[model samples]
Target chain A: MQTFHFDPVDLPPGIPAFRAEIRAFLAREMPRDYPAEQKANCWTVYDADFSRRLGERGWIGMHWSKTYGGHERSALERYVLMEELLAAGAPVGAHWIGDRQTAPAILRYGSESQKQRHVPRIARGEAFCCIGMSEPNAGSDLASVRTRAERLPDGRWKINGQKIWTTLAHRSHLIIVLARTSPADEKNRHAGLSQFLLEFDTPGLRVQPIVDLVGAKHFNEIFFEDCIVDAECLLGTEGQGWKQVTAELSLERSGPERYLSSIALFFELLRVVGPSPSESVRQAIGRVTAEIWTLRQMSLSVAGQLARGEDPYVEAAIVKDLGNVFEQALPPLVQALADDGIHLEQDSDFVRTLALLLQTSPSFSLRGGTREILRGIIARGLGLR
Target chain B: MSEQRQILADTADRLFADAVTSRRIEGFDAKLWQQTIEMGLPLLLAPEADGGAGGDWDDAGAVLHALGHHGVPIPLAENMIAAQLAADAGLELPSGPVSLATRVEGALQQAGTRFDGKLLGVPWGRHADAILAVVPGHTVLLRRTDATSLRHAHNLADEPRDDLIFDNAPAVCGPASDGTQASHLLALARCAQISGALEAALHKSVEYAQTRKQFGRAIGQFQAVQQQLAQFGAEVAAAMCATRAACRAATRGDASFQIAAAKLRCNLAIGFATSTAHQVHAAIGFTREFDLRQSTQRLWSWRTEGGNDRAWADVLGARVCARGDQFWADLTARDDAVSLT
Candidate 1:
């Protein structure tokens, strides 16, 4: 593991300068009519063309190699870029998963030709990808997924079954899916699973948006009646899908995204409330700040570990488990602080963001594996499981 | 910065785990107490030649963190705090727990006729060679073997929190701490212990949340309970950061505002984390059969022991007000080594 020369959360001098460059670029191309609220932390409302703009600037694949249209930047540089984007509430949501995680996976585990085929387009944000891990019945029990992919005569794969809770499926160009390629055996339930990279417009593929509790069409149920892909589209070897997807999940779970999503709303809550806080509000905010700050340290530590090319699976689980708590806490704390006649959408972008966050906060703990699954991982790490 | 601290912390963690869990710590464990004394933990503040440990706050912090982590039943923190105070008074480190050598009369006025003020709840006082007691303006060291001791009652968690009546027992008297010095050190020490207990408690809570599934999923998956775990996680981490930082300051002999901040943070973190551990786990955490109670119960007692949220907040408020008057440069002095790392 690479020893962290300093805290991973602290942006390097090279990156703060990079931040200035990106800010200037965003100020210019963000479109005067851009949904400014999209720039608030996790509340980034999806805008396809805007995300494509980011891809065109090579901002989407900031850490990928230049040979792959990636900036070949240090992980710390990526850290700076991701935090700034999320903080500004950029509408990068359309291609976030693909650019931040899927592309990274392809770069590391995909064949060289596969990297050449997808990396550049991903860098330009023209190609978007969605995660297909959560199925209707196997949302948290990833090993129990029933979506099946079978090898056909022509060496192509015929995938049949359904995937649900696939976020932003309607807008993405492609999806990275986890499928069961074998029957469940006496071994661990995770055995026999496989992964596939399928195009959105594939002959048998269908996308139906899954409206969340807040009535947003951000997530969807993707039906694979007979979705077919060439053998080259397999994410990894058969039965190796479990390991590859796990590595991907760790990347998905460990970033600064988990916590920063609520920071904008939090700052808004403070501003809408007042200068001097009530005792209860003061205590709650103090407690919340302490937790968020500590989790940031833990998350950054994991980032440092990852920068050294460490998997940090357990650390990532810890951050996810802790982050859900932080995110979930914000809605109620915001409500409690703003109980004095403040509305979720009071003709202000800030209020609208709070409304959206309140509607979205409940899923914070449910998405990306349930709290129990995460705790199970953490327990095993602590030797308690 | 030093490996010696890790050695001391690891050793103490092992011994305390064995002793506390074994129920060998009856307010104090004599043999283990001597082992700690031999480790020179008590004389950590003493000069190297004075038969003391001569370690810094970082060293003391490691020891305190271990004592908390393992739920050491004895008042190791209190004894250590007293030792530091006594040593700073240009005196030799007495063997065991000091009743803080504070005036029983004043404590009685505060306690409203409940001030028999013998060193009850005193760790190793049940086994100390001598009890450090302070009269109106005098600090006295009295032998425990002199029949000058009286017993009291056991506390809620059964730590032997009785009373001691000095009645001017034949003892060596020195000088009392002029004002709130003893109180401050005592509160800071308690905060450190509480931080450790919170850490242990949160760990137990997380384990339970992951393992105990209902409705076909671990209860932790539920948003309500996950919120509890998350809150405790944050508090536990915050308390740890604060407590360790404060312990660092105390060991350096600086005892700055950061110490007060640490104390305040730990007080709230422990209070909330412990209560939530019980709430989230519900019946399981409430039962004495589990290890969760061990840490939570200790936290409950420690909250009221050295100080509570209100007391620490007062200290925090005063410190902030103090800074409000200092020149901006002084208040935000860069490299104020006293600031937490």
Candidate 2:
């Protein structure tokens, strides 16, 4: 078996200057009295204005080419910006997907015209994108997707399919859809799939909200019936959608976002427990802190390997899988720690934030990829399958 | 890694890979110990002016990591720490292996270059040439011949862990050392060792799972085994990353929280790796006939050597709690957080 490498990664020498600039910007831009619950939902708290402000500072799409409105920064520079934004609980979801994966996808696979059209707008935070991968029956088994896209006589594509669990579909200006371009071969089930970029304004396409277990409207169910797209919208070569989508998913899974979803509650727990806490509370906090540090280092190593053009797919999967465990285990432990007789004022910011975090903790594992699927990928890399 | 560091690590790996076999760790071999010392393994962390390699913590940490991977059954790690301590105290480095102890169960009294105490759980204390003890005021080096008696013991790996009684023993004492900081430094050393052994345990388990057949197929084909191995891989990765950072912090001489966190994390990784390794190997892993026990048992023994998860976790938790509102700021601002040392 090939050995998995996770060398230690150091931020660039000038990272402190970049960190200081972001901190100063965040201090000046973030609201003075933002709601406590908002911090708990920072990843899903869409704010176009905040994203645009970050875009104005050349923070968004910092790793792409300058010709496409990017700042031509290193991957380490982008990593610094992302960690700082997540640590402060910034509202960056409005442009997070586009800046993170969609823009990179276009830059990597799209035609030059496509790059000039979408990459510039995404970098400016004036456009947004949502992924279309999961279907009603193909949640974990992505190769079983039945969405069909047929070539039309007028050189356009006609699509008919339903995508489920599409996050922020209604708000996005474009949807990157995966569909079957030809009949599936029994020998290679992953060969016949293809990808297309569909605008949200296309007729016969509808997005209906899928409210989560918590009373939040972050997910959607999109229905496409005879939805037509121009011939130029196809991403990369035809029949290579599975490969492109898998590459995009790698970018989705390997980032600071995977592990920092529960950090706000940790800060709140500190505020509530105060100084000189019991041994149990201290142990819990210490364990979580150690785990967080380890995960960040692992993620950073993956980022470093990615910067050097290495496909660290197995290591990235391991990070997301372990990251989910850390994030999911926090709320229950925090609840047990605070279950003592001490009464928390109902309106206290600490109590409100804890309540919100406890409600939303379950979704951490379901997003990006489920636990079982990620482990399966890890097992494949380990040569166990 | 620098070329020099890579060469040091490679040399250690080759030497220990031959000296450390399943047959060797079953019993102590004094000849193997002498061969190790002849290669200047113990002096890797000492100053150049003191007739040593004069390498930093990161350099020595790499060497110790390679030795740990081979489950080398000598006092190499302890001797490395002792030589550094002796250098810090401005004393002549000893000729043989030295064990370090910053705490003792019984009272240690000093009177005119003499010490009296009962030090417990000293690793390889029976075979050590000298005992480097950092007392409340001064750091003293006592020869093994001065010990009044010895109560021999063994850890999970069957390595010597002896208790020594010193009654008015003559010592070469030096200036006072920071006892607390010394303990934290030892903890960092132990973390480096544990991370290396964890990787070995994981590699062995994965190899076994692929080769061992069950029900007409490899056991690794089972989902249950695959999932367990995946978790073990994550634990190894975490331990290795944390240990590397702690070594860097040690080189900077500001290893307060980094060392504590690393020790705690490595201990946790050891717990998961040892148990899962035994489970994956089934009954064969429990027997001393197999190489898995060498690594797993050493992990079981090393986690509690410098300080276990509980001890270091308490120190780490107290520091974080004491920071109060400054916690978030310090955590995000790596400079402020690390400089708190």
Winning candidate number (DockQ): 2
Compared with the true structure, the alpha-carbon lDDT of candidate 2 equals: 0.83
* lDDT tens per residue, model 2, B157-193: 8988888999988878777657676688778887878
Interface RMSD of candidate 2, in Å, is: 3.1
Candidate 2 chain B: 10-residue stretch with minimal lDDT: B332-341
Q: Which CAPRI level is candidate 1?
A: incorrect
What is every candidate's C-alpha DockQ against the true complex, given to 2 decimals? 0.08, 0.50
| Residue lDDT tens for model 2, A148-249 | 999999989999989999988989997789999999888999998999987899998999999887678988999999988889989998999999999999
**Model 2 segments beyond 4 Å from truth?**
A1-3, A342-345, B105-112, B335-341
> Can you write out model 1's per-residue Cα lDDT over A1-385, one digit (the tens) per residue?
1111212233344543566687777667665765434555453366778888877776778778999888877886676567667655667687788877899988878888778998888888788888889887987778889999999999999999999887888888878889999887666887898888777888999888766676667888889997778899888678988898888888888888887777777556555445545566555544554454455555656776788787877667767777787787787777766768777557786677677777777777787778777766654554434
How much native contact recovery, as a fraction, does model 1 achieve?
0.01
Per-residue alpha-carbon lDDT of candidate 1 for residues B1-341, written as tens digits (9 for 90 to 100): 35777687778778778776667454656667667777776666566776666776667776776787777555566566666556655556555554453324423232222223355455445555655554455444556665345575554556655455654345554466554666667677767677677877877777777789889987776766765565566566556655554555465555655555666667667667877888868887777677777687777777777656655555444333334323212322311332334
**Which ten residues in a row are the worst by lDDT in model 1 chain A?**
A1-10
* Model 1 TM-score on chain A: 0.91
